[model samples]
Target chain A: AQSVTQPDIHITVSEGASLELRCNYSYGATPYLFWYVQSPGQGLQLLLKYFSGDTLVQGIKGFEAEFKRSQSSFNLRKPSVHWSDAAEYFCAVGPSGGTYKYIFGTGTRLKVLA
Target chain B: DAMVIQNPRYQVTQFGKPVTLSCSQTLNHNVMYWYQQKSSQAPKLLFHYYDKDFNNEADTPDNFQSRRPNTSFCFLDIRSPGLGDAAMYLCATSRDQGGYTFGSGTRLTVV
Candidate 1:
């Protein structure tokens, strides 16, 4: 079965610091990976996705992720964190060609401090 | 201005009472999905409608039901909602293109 894993449950980073959230996926074939962010009391918003082509994908809100096929990883990164970036991040994976159902990771909560 | 819209942003219901949550989309996408998200947990897919076809997840409770009356409207019905059912219910829509557009979500609270 296809699944996603987010190792960190919670992470705290000071404002202006860099951020990295790790994600790993298990699938038998090429995967369609995605990163989504959810603010408190709000629905999830898509940050980025990697379907095919370039490994590095850029997304909204200055977020970027790199898809490593060898490691089955799609790690979300932000060079400089802001107070507004504090939210829960989820990594999802779907089959390259099949059902559109997405398997999501447990999610990582990012706490930004000044 | 196309987006997914969920009604009753915050819903409060008595335990064991049935309640309905609604979702509508202006994107006119072929697929609409419902997800249940508990506190600090990943969102779980309850079901989805590809056009008029309803697809339910295997582990979804029988108390939870969905209806897609039209391409633009979808409803989630909870029969005898329990305290455990208090969580955020999200609605999303997508086309053949990758990535889904999610609504603001309905926060369901069973008292």
Candidate 2:
């Protein structure tokens, strides 16, 4: 079974500080990794995805993620956090092939302090 | 911009009453999916339509059903409402092996 895990349930970061959200996935083969952000009462918005090629992938809102094959991790990062960056972040994994179903992590809620 | 659209941003329904949530996509994707997201939790897959074929998750309840009448529209129908069923229902669309485009979602409230 494919699964994604986000260890942090909540995180607090001051505005303009760097941010990192940890994510780990379990799958038999190379997985397609994705990061998504959701605001309160809103649908999820895709931040970035890792299909192949370079390990580091850039996404919207100045977010980026690096896929580490050895540790089975895909951590999301932002160089400078803003107030609007406060949201729930989810890591998801889909099979390299076959079904399109994506397995998502429980999510990590980030709070930004100005 | 082409995107997935879900109607009824919020819905209130009485217990045991039926409710339907609608989704439409302008991307003309081959797959349309429905997910149920509880408060502060990951979205759980309910079902999806690969074109006109419907696929249901193993753990999905029979009371929850879906219909994709065309390539651009899909509907999620709950036969009876329960307090536990209150959730943010999301609709998404995608081409084969492509990333998904999610709609704003419908927040279902059971009273």
Candidate 3:
């Protein structure tokens, strides 16, 4: 079974500071990776995804993630995070050959300090 | 813009009462999914409809059922609400594009 792990349960970062949220996955074959963000009292919104060719993928809200095959990791990063960016983040993995089932990480709570 | 839409942003029901949550999409995607998300937890897949075919997860309880009347609409029915079933119900639609578009979600409260 494919699974995802977000090592950090919570992370606090000052506004305008760079941020990184770590994610690792265990899968037998090449995987499709995704990052999603959920604000309080709201549903999840897709941040970014890595499908095939590009190891690095850019997403909405100035977020980017790099897929490292060797490490079985796809970590999300932003050069500068805004206060509005504070939310819970999830990392997910799906099988490569048209499998729609996605295994998600527990989540990482992001707090933005002014 | 094309998007997924879920109805009744919030719902309140008594324990053991039946409740239904609705979702509709304009994206015309072949897949629609229902997910249960408890407070601060990752969303768990309950079931999905691929076109007209229904697929339920192995662990999904029988108390939960779903209906996808057509490609544009899907409904999740909870036969008996439990305190543990109180959570956000999310609806999503996707294609082969590898990304899913999600609705704002319906937050359910069981009293």
Question: For each of the candidates, what fraction of the native contacts does it recover?
Answer: 0.81, 0.75, 0.81
Best by TM-score: 2
Cα lDDT tens digits, model 3, A1-114, are 678999999999999999999999999988888999999988889998888998999999999999999999999999999999999999989852355778889999999999
Which window of 10 residues has the lowest lDDT sum in candidate 3 chain B? Answer: B92-101
TM-score of each: 0.97, 0.98, 0.97
Between prediction 1 and prediction 2, which has the larger TM-score?
2
What is candidate 1's local distance difference test score?
A: 0.93
* Candidate 3 runs further than 4 Å off: A96-98
Interface Cα RMSD for all candidates? 1.3, 0.8, 1.3
lDDT of 1 by residue, A34-108 (tens): 999999999999999999999999999999999998998999999999999999999988842377688889999
For candidate 1, the per-residue lDDT at B15 reads 100
Q: Decide which is better by DockQ, 2 or 3.
A: 2
| Model 2: number of backbone collisions | 0
lDDT of 1 at A46: 95
The parts of candidate 1 lying over 4 Å away from their true place are none
TM-score of chain A as modeled in candidate 2 = 0.96
**Pairs that collide, model 2:** none
Judging by DockQ against the true structure, name the best candidate: 2
